[model samples]
Target: MDEQIITNELLKRYLQGKCTVAEQQLIADFLDDPNNLILLHQIMAEQTNSLWDSSADVPQHDRGQITVWQRRLHERMEEEQLIPSDKTKPNLRKRGIIPIRQRIQWYAAAILLFVGLGALLWLWIPQGAKPSEQLVHQKNRITPGSDRAILKLADGSTISLSDAAKGSIADQGGVKVQKTAEGEIVYAAVDKRASTQSYNSINTPNGGQYRVTLPDGSRAWLNAASSLTYPVEFEKKERRVKMTGEVYFEIAKITNENKERVPFFVETDKQVIQVLGTTFNVNAYADEPYDCTTLLEGSVRLVAAHSGKSELLKPGQQALVGNNMLLSEADIQQNLAWINGYFIFRREDLGGILRKIARWYDVTVECPPELSTMKFTGKVSRSQSLSAVTEMIASINKVKLEIKERRIIVKK
Candidate 1:
C-alpha cells in the first residue's frame, strides 16, 4: 500500500468524526511526515464546512475566538513560505545586471502599479503591464439573508409574498392572516381551535425571507430559500414539523393533559431538533451544503440521523451537521437577527460570510484568495440593495468592490 494512502485514510476518518485517541495520535504522527506537510495545502483547500446566516453580527466573545484562529492560520501560512527550497532559478531580467531578490521586488512593484492604475494607462504603455496580477488575498463581506421566496401549501396553493400585498390571506379557525406590507407573513389567532388537525407552511426563495405566527401562538421566521411544514395546530404527546432552508421558532408553552411539557420537534433532511417550549433556529436549506440548528432561548437536543450522535444545546448554542458534525455555542441574539431584517457579521471569514451573502443576494462572487482567509465584523440592512451593503463593508475592509450588473467582484 502507498504511504500517502494511509495518510488520506486517516484524514477521511477524521473528517467523518470517527477519530479516537489512538487515531488522533496517528494523524498527528502522519502530519509530521514530509509528504503530508506538502499535502496540507491541498487538504485545507478542498475541505468544506457548514454555516447558517442568522443575519446578525457575531457576538463580541465569539468574534474574539474566531480572530485567534484567523491569526493562527495567517501565521502558519507565513511560516510555510520561509521553508528552504533548492528550486530557485536565476533572474532572466537585464542579463544578471542586478541581484535576483532586488530585481524581483522591482518588477513586482512595477506590475502592481500598472494593475492598480487603469485601462487608460494601458492605452499609453502596453509593455511591462502585467495582465491580471494579484496582490493580497482580500477577504469579503457577508450579506444578510434576502427577503425573496414563494410560499407553497400542501394543497397546491402558491403565495408570492416576494412582491405582493401583505394583508389578510384567509380567516381559518378565526385566525387573521396578514402581511405587514413589509413582506412578513403572519397569522393571528382571534378564535381558539378545539380541533387540532390543520396545517400551514411558509417557504423562501434563493434570495428571500419571511416571518409567520402559528395558530397555537408560536412564532417563526423563515430564511432564504427555506420552508417550514408545520400544522396550524399542534397536538398532545408531541408537536412535529419538517423544515427546509432555515426557520427560527418561538414555541408556545404547552401544559399537556399530564401537565408535563411535551417536546416539539423540528424535523429536517438528516436530523431532528427536539424541543419542549423554547425559541431556536433551524437552518436546513436544500441549496446549502449542510444543515444547522442554532438555539436561542430554552434547552434543545439535536439527534443526528446518520451517526446516531445526539447533542444537547443550551441557549446561545449552535450545531452544524454535514459530512461531519461540529457543535459550538454562539450569541443567540446576533444569530437570530434575521427575524428583524438585517445581517450582522462579527469577524466572520470572507468565504464563510460570502456563501450566506450569495444565497441572500442571489448573486455570484469572485474575490481575492487572501480575502477568503481574512475576517470582518459589521452590520448591513437586507432591506437595501446588495451592492449598497457590499460597498459599505468593502470600504471598511480596505478593499475595492465592483458590481457589474448583478455580479459582485472584489479587488485589492
Candidate 2:
C-alpha cells in the first residue's frame, strides 16, 4: 500500500467505523508492516498539527463507537498474530520501537496510535543523559507532597503545622488544639463560654493535605490547596464552617441543650450544604465549572449561594450548583477517592485529570486546548511520585507526558 494514498479523512472514517468491510481489511493489511507504524505516526502528527491550527476541523467521534471499533481491531490483529507476544517485545525494540512494558489493552493501544503519540517523540531518552542519570534526575525533580498546612489562630497568630511538634499546638478560647501523630488536628474544649467568639482556620497548600476534628466532633478531610475556617467551639444557632476548595466531611451528630440534633453547615462561595450526621464530599475548586456535593451517607440539603435555590440529596446522590442547580445519582467511590489517597477517573476528560495532577503534584500543567476532549478511565495511587504517576498515565493512555522542572506539558 502506498503511504501517500491514505488520506486523513479516510483514516478518520476508518477509526470512526464508517469504513466498509473491504476498506477495513485494506487498513488492517496496511498496518501489518512494523515500519508502517512510524509512517502512521507521521501522518497523525501532521493531522494533529492541522487540527491545532483550525480546531473547527476536528472530528467529533463518539467515544463508545471508538471503543467498539478499537476492540474489533484488537481481536482482528490478535487473530492474525500481528500484536507482538511477550517473547517478541525484544524484537520490536530492535526494530526501533519501544518495547511494551506489558500487553496494553485494546482501547489504550488504539488511542496510543491515533489520539496520542507522535512517533514516540517524548518517550525517547535525551541524547546526553544516561538511563540511570535520567531516572535519578526525575526522582529529584518530581517528588510527592508531604504533610503540610498553615493554621491561623483567632488571635491573628499563625502556626506552620508541618513544622509544629505533635502536641497541643494552641488554645483557642478554651478549646485546646492538639496535633496528633497522624498529622490530624483535634480540638478539646476545656471550658464552655456561651458567647465565645473565637474562630480558627487551616489552609493546605498545593501538594498538601490535612485532616481536622472540629470542636463539635465533625471531621473534615482537606484536599490540596483547600481551606476550612470554623469557630473554636460550636455555638449560636448552628454548627457552620466556611470552606474553599475540595473537602470530605464526616459530620458528627451533635445535640443541643434541647436534645435536638444541630445541623452542620458547609458554606462555600457557590452553595451551602446542610447536614446532620452525614458523610459527603464537596468539590468547589475555583477553576471547576460547578460546585459539586456528593452525599455518601444520611442526607444533605444544598442551597445555592446566590439564588437560594434548594435541593435535597439522598445518600447516593450528587448536587451540582452552577448557573443552574442539578441533582443526579452519585459515584461515591469516585467522590471520596482523594480522601482515600487515590485518583479515580471514570470516563473523565484529560484536562480535568491533568488539573488534579497539577494540584496534588504541586506543578503547573499545560495541556493543548485541542486535547481537552480526550478522556481516560483508571485509578492511580496518590502516594506515587509525580514521575511515576505521569508514567503510568502515559503507559495506560499512550499519551506523552513531558515534565520540565515544576511544569508538565501534555502533547498528543
Candidate 3:
C-alpha cells in the first residue's frame, strides 16, 4: 500500500475510535494488507482457532506477536509513502487537491519550520522538555472502561458483564433498557414485582461499571467492580437497595405507610444509609479497602453493618466506612468525582492515586520506588485525550510515568 494513501491523521483518528465508517474502512484496508492478512493466518495456524478466540489463551498465545506485525506493517507503509489522510475536512468546495510538487514543497517547508523551532527550544528550554500530546508517550495516565466485571445475582448465578452482549436480555419490571457497547447500561423500570418474587443483582468487576434504574423512578449509576441488588418494585412503605461497589443514586421519594418520614435506604457492605430525597454517591469497591458514602444534596447516615456504629454526613461531608471503623466529614466532591466524569486529585500520593486509577481505567499500576512517594494535585478530565494526560504528568519534575496502551508504568 502506498504511504500517500494512509494519512497520519487517519491513523490517529482510527486509533481514537473517532473515524467515520468510510475513514475507518480506508484505515482497515491499509492495515489489512495482503502481508498482514497472511500474518494473522500464520498466527492462527500456530494456534488452534479455539485458542485464538479465547481471552485467556489469545494473549498468552500471540498478542505481542500481533502487535509486532502491526507495527512492522505501519512502518513499511510509512516508509513507502502510502495514502495521505485529511487532517482537517474543510468544505469540499472550498479546498481542492494540491499538485504533488506543491505538497512536496509544503512538506519541506514544514520540516524547516520544525527544525528552527527545535534549535530555539534546545537553548531556551530546560534539559528535559515535557512530552507533548503529539508524542503519544507511554506514560499517559488516562483510564478507560476496562472490560472486567462479574455480575452476581441473588440466585447465585454470576454473569460477567465485562464482555457480555450489549443488548436487552430480559425484562426488569417495566423498564426496557439495553446494555450499551461502551458498558453504560440503561433501563426504564417496569412495575411487575409480586409479593413473593425475588430480587436480582449485578456486580461489576474491579475494572467495570454499569447503570440501572429502579421501578420507582429512581436512577443508579454503578462504578467499577461493584454489585447491587434490588427488588423488581418498591412494594413497600419505603424503598431499599443493597450495594457492594460504588453507585450514584437519584432517589424518587415514596410515601410512608403512616406518613412518618418514610425514606429510601441504601445498604452497603458496611453501612445502612438512609436517603429520602436527594443525590448521593457510594463507593464500596472491596479492593479499595476504604468504602465511601458521599452526599451531594441530601443527608445520609452511615452505620456499621455489624457494630451499629453510625455517623451522619452533611451535604458536602462523606463517610468512610472501613472494616473496623467509620469516619465522617470527608471530602464529598473528591470521592464522588468519578460519577461526574472527572478524576480530581488533591495532593494524593502515588499509591492512593493508583487505587483510583486501577478501578476506573481497569489497569494495574506499577510504581517504581522513586516515584511511589510522589503526590499529585490537579484536575484530569476523564474525557481527556489519553496522550494529553501522558504529557501533563510528564510536566511534573523528578517523577515519570509511561503509558503503554492500556497499562501504565511509573518511573523515577
Candidate 4:
C-alpha cells in the first residue's frame, strides 16, 4: 500500500469506524515504517485544526460520539503498549523491515495517532466531558489556582493581596507599600533616614502565589505555600530576607556609604545564600527531603546551616543541601517553571509530582504504595484546572484518578 494514498479523508473515515479491513491493514503497514510517523504527526495536526475550525458546526449529539471515540482510542492505545507503559525501556526497532511482534507494536502507534486527535478535540470542544467526569460525577468542579497572598505588616496588621484594592496598602516604618495594577506589591523608601526599621512578611497559602518588589528594588516571586520576610527598608550595610517554601529572587546591586558593594542574604532552614548581585531560586519546603538553590544569573554562595559546608554556584549550576551539599548542572527551565506558569517534570516520581500538585491545587492526594515510585516526564500549564491536569497524568501514565471532594485518589 502506498503511504501517500492514506489521505486525511481515509483517516477520518477510519476514526468514524467506516474503514474497511484492508484499509486498517494499510494503516498498520504505514505505521510499521518508522519514517511514516512524521507523516502521522502531520496528519494529526491537520485533523485537529480541521476539527477545531468546524467544531461549532458539529451537531450536539455528534459531539458525544466524538468524545466516546477519543476515550476508546486512548484506551486501546494504552492496552497495546504503544504509549510506552514503562518509560525506562529503549526502542530496538531498525529502519528496515520488522518482525510480527514489531508490526503489532506499530499497530499501537496507529491507535496513538488517532488518540492524539481525540485528545485535542476534547480540549477544543467545550461540550465534551472532562476526563474526571468519566471517573465520578461530582457536585463541584475544582478550578485552577491564581495570584493571591497575605501581607503581614510590621504593626501586626494583615492585608489580603487578593482582595486589597490596587493602591497603597500600608505604610511600614519609613517605607510606602503599594500594590500595583498588575497585582505586585512594591515597597519604596519614603524616609530613608527614619530611625525605626521594621519587618514585614508576605505569605502565599495553598493554591496561591504572589510577587513582590523589595525596598532595594529587588524582585521576588513566591510560589504556593511560601513565605518571605524582609525589613521594610534595607539597612545601610546589607539586605537580608528569611523565606520558606519556594521563592525566586532577582537581587539588585547597591553600595554602602563608602561605595562598597552591599551583599544580600537569603535564609532558609537548611542554608543561607549570599549574593552580590544575582538571580536565583530557593526551594526549601520542609516536607521535601532536600533544599535546592538554583542560580540563573550572576554568582551566589550557599552555606549549609548545620554542617557549615558551602558551595559557590555559577549561572547554570545548582546546589542541593541535604546530608551533604551536592552541586550539579541545573535544569533552569524546570527550576523556574512555576514562576513561568508551568509544571515541568523530567523523570520525576509520581509522589514528588503529586506533592507539587497538592500545594498548588490545595488538595489532598492519596497515592497507592505501588504507584508512588512510578516515574513520569511531562509538562503541564499551571493555569489548567485540577481535573484537566489530573486527566493528563492519568491518561499518559495509564492509571485511574478519582476526585472525591477535594482529594485525588490514584489507583492502578
Candidate 5:
C-alpha cells in the first residue's frame, strides 16, 4: 500500500480546485473519519475566520459565533465525561487547542450548537458509527472507468493503450508514438520530410476514455465508445480528422505556405465543423437522435452533411443536425461534463440519462415505458459506482432498481 500524507497546503489546493484527480482522491481517503477532524481543523485554521471567507465563498457570518460554539463544545466534553482518563491516555497528538478525542467531542458539541442534537450525537459518538458512513460501506458497487482504449497504427497493427507500458510504443512513418505515465498518447514527428502522411486511429470502448496529442499539437479527449482517425503528419493543405461517437477538441492554430491560418476540419456523420483555433465538443453517436456540436471557445462553422446548409457558431452555442439542422444557445459546461468527470442532467429524460449510464457502466438497462419519460435535473460525479448512482436516483424519484447479473431493471 502507498503511504499518503496529507498536508495543510494540499488541503488548501484541494479547496481551491487546483489539485489533480489523484490528490483529490488522497484527501478523500483521509477524510473518512471524525478522528481526522484534526486535519479538517488545520485546513480551516489556515483560512479566513468567517465562513464566507472560506473556499466556498458563500454567505458571511460572525467569527465570534464559531469561537462561541468551540467553547461550548469544550465545556460539554468535560460535562459528559467523554474524554479519556489520564491513566488510560492514548499517545495522542494535538493539532489544535484540544486532544484528539476531546477535539471530536468539541465537534459533536458544535453540531449541537447548530443542529440542536447534542443528546443524540452524545450517545452516537461513543459508538463511532455514522449513518452516511455505514451506507458507503456497501460491498456491491460498480467501479468507474479508467484509462482504457485501443490504438490502431497505420500498419494495421493495434495496441491496447491502457495496458501498454509507458514509453515509446511504436514509430509511424517517422513519427514517434509514446504512451505517457498520464495514460495519454503523444506523437513526436521526427522527420517532416516524409512524402506521404500515414493515418492512425484510436478507439475507446464502453467504460473507457483516452487522450491524444495530434501531430499538429492539437489535443483531443475521446469519451466512451468513440473513435478518432487522424494522419501521422499534417502535410495536407488543411488538417482534417474523422471521428465517430463523441469527442472534445482543442484545435491548434497552424499556418500554410500562403501565410494564412490553415483551417482544421472535423467530419462526423451529420455535419462537418471547421475551425482555426478553438475548443469544442462533438456528440455524433450512432444511437443518439441528433449529431450535436457545442462550441466552447473561439468560433466554428458547422455544415450539415445532407443539406450542405452552414451555420456559424459562437462560444456557448450549439448546432444540432439530424433530419433537420438547428442552432441554439448551449450550456458549455453541461456538454463538457463527461470529460471533466461528471454527469450534469438538466431536466433530461430518464431514458436519455440511462443511456449515458449504460454506456459508462457498460450495462444493459430495462425500464417500464411509463418511467422512460421521467425527467431528472442534477449533477452526479462520474466516479461514483453505478449502483450508488442508481440508488440515489431511485430514492429521489420514488422508484426501485432490480439488479440481475449485469442488467438493471428500473421500476416504479
Candidate 6:
C-alpha cells in the first residue's frame, strides 16, 4: 500500500474504534515497516507541536504516559527481532528475523501499542485540534439541520413548531393539534361534527425537517424545504393530502361505516399517488427534472398530472414522472435516506447530490456545467457539520469545494 494512504483522519478513526476490520489490517501493515514507523513518529511530533504552543502547559502525567508507551514500543520491537538488542550492538547487521506468522503476531502487538499512543495523543489535544473542529475552523462552520417547521392553521395563523411549547398548540374546528415531547406534531379529532374541509399545513424551511401524525393515525415525515397540506380531519370516504419537495408517508388503512378500506391520495405537481395502505417516499422538488415516487410497502398507483399516464408500483419499485412515466426497481434505502438521517448516493450526479446538501445545510452551490454531470457514490451522516460533509465529497471525487459565506463553489 502507498504510505500516503495512512492519513491523520484514518489514524483518528482507527483510534476511535470506528474503522473496519480491513482498515485495521491495513493500518497494521503500514506500521510494520520501519520507515513508516519513522514517518508516523514525525507526523505525531508535528501534530503535537501544531496543537500545543510553547507556553501551553501540557500535564506532566500526559508527558510521562507518552514516554512510557514509546519505551514499551521500543522493547517490543527489540523482542520481535525488528531491531538489534543493546547487548548485540556489534552484530546489528547479522540479526535473524522471525517467521511470517510470528511476524504477523508481532505486528498485531505493535498495532495495539500504536493504538494506545494514538488514543493518548487524541485525548491530549485540545478540543479545537480535533478532526471535526479542525475542519470547522479551516472552513467556516455550518451546522446540521434540526427538527423545525411552521404549522399553518385554517384561520391563516402560523405557529412555529420549533418554539412552541410541548403541548396543545392549536385547535382547528374541533380538531386538537399537539406538539409532542419527541418534536413531532400530531392531530386528533375530538368531535365527530368537525368539518373535514378545514385544512392545515406544515412547512419546513431550508436546514429543517419535521414529522406529523395525521388524524387517521398515518404519519408523514417532511424533509428540508418541504410542505404538506391536509384536511384537519379526513372525510369518511378517503384521506387526501398535497405536498411539495420531498416527504415520506406511512399510510394507515381506514375503513368507513361500510367496512371498506378508504383509499389515501397524495398530490404532487407532477403526479398523483393513490394507495390503500402503504409506505412510500415522494420527491417532487421543482428544481429536479422528474418527480419520483418510491414504494416501500403495499401498492400504489401513480398517475401523471399532465399527460394522464399511469403506472402501478409494487414494493421496491419506483415511478419517475416527467415528460413520460418510467417504472423500474428502486434503491429503497437511497430513496428513504433523508428520513433515516443520512445522505446516501449511488452513482448519483454531482448536481443532484449538491442540491440535497444545499437544502439540508441551507447553502447555495455553484457548479460548472461540466462538473455538474460528474457522478459520485458515498454515504455521509446528515448530522455532520457542512465542512465535514463537503470535505468527504471533495476527497471522494478528487475535486475541491470552497465555501464562501453561505455559498459553495465547486472546482475541479
Off-target runs (Cα >4 Å) in candidate 2 are 1-139, 193-195, 396-398
Q: Tens digits of per-residue lDDT for model 2 on 1-412?
A: 1111112333354456553332222233335464545433333333343334543534456344444544554565567655655565335456665544243322223344532211111222112221111111244657677678999998899999999999999976667999999989999988875235778999999999889999888999899999999988877459999999899999999887888989989999999888989999999999999999999889988899879899899988999998889999888878888877777777687899888989998999888887765656656568777876675455432347878789887765
- Using lDDT as the measure, what is the rank order of every candidate, best first? 6, 4, 2, 5, 1, 3
Quote the lDDT for 376 in model 3.
Answer: 60
Local accuracy by lDDT, each model: 0.58, 0.70, 0.56, 0.72, 0.68, 0.73
RMSD values for the candidates in order, in angstroms, are 19.2, 14.6, 17.8, 12.2, 14.2, 13.3
Better of 2 and 6 by lDDT: 6
Residue 21, candidate 1: alpha-carbon lDDT: 33
Candidate 3 lands at a TM-score of 0.56
Global CA lDDT of candidate 6, please? 0.73
lDDT of 6 at 338: 89
Write model 1 residue lDDT over 1-412, tens digit each, in one string.
1100112222223334543332232233333344323233322222212111233343444334333433443355457662234474223343322222222222122122112111110111112322232222224533445566676643567777666676787665665667776666676767675245666777776677777766566778777777888765567778888888778889988878889987788888889888888988887766566787887779988888788788888877789887667888776646775666656666566676776777787778888898675566545456655655564444332456676555678776
When sorted by TM-score, best at the front, the candidate numbers are 4, 6, 5, 2, 1, 3
User: Evaluated with lDDT, which candidate comes out highest?
Assistant: 6
Error of 4 at 328 (Å): 1.1
After best superposition, candidate 4 residue 212: deviation in angstroms? 0.4
What value of lDDT does candidate 4 attain over all alpha carbons? Answer: 0.72
- Model 1 gets an lDDT of 0.58
Residue 408 displacement (Å), model 4: 1.1
Q: Write the per-residue lDDT of candidate 5 for residues 1-412, one digit (tens) a residue.
A: 1111222222233234453332233233333334434333433343324343445433223345545544554454556554446585334354223432333332222222222111001111113211221112235667777778999988899999978999999986678999888878999979765435578999999888889999889999999889999988876588889999899999988888788989999999888899989999999999899998999898999889889999899999998899889999998768888987888776677888888888888788998888777666655678877765675455332356766666778866
Question: Compared with the true structure, what per-residue lDDT tens digits does model 3 show for residues 1-412?
Answer: 1112112222233334443332222233324344333332233333333334555422342344334444564465557554234563233234332222222222222122121111110111122333333223654445466445555543566566656688875554454545676675555554554332557777776556677666567888877767788865555667788987678898876676676656788887777887877888888766666777778787777778867887767787777777666555666657777876766676676677777666666667777766655556545555444544444444443346666767667665
Residue 267, candidate 4: Cα error in Å is 0.5
Residue 36 CA error for candidate 3 (Å)?
51
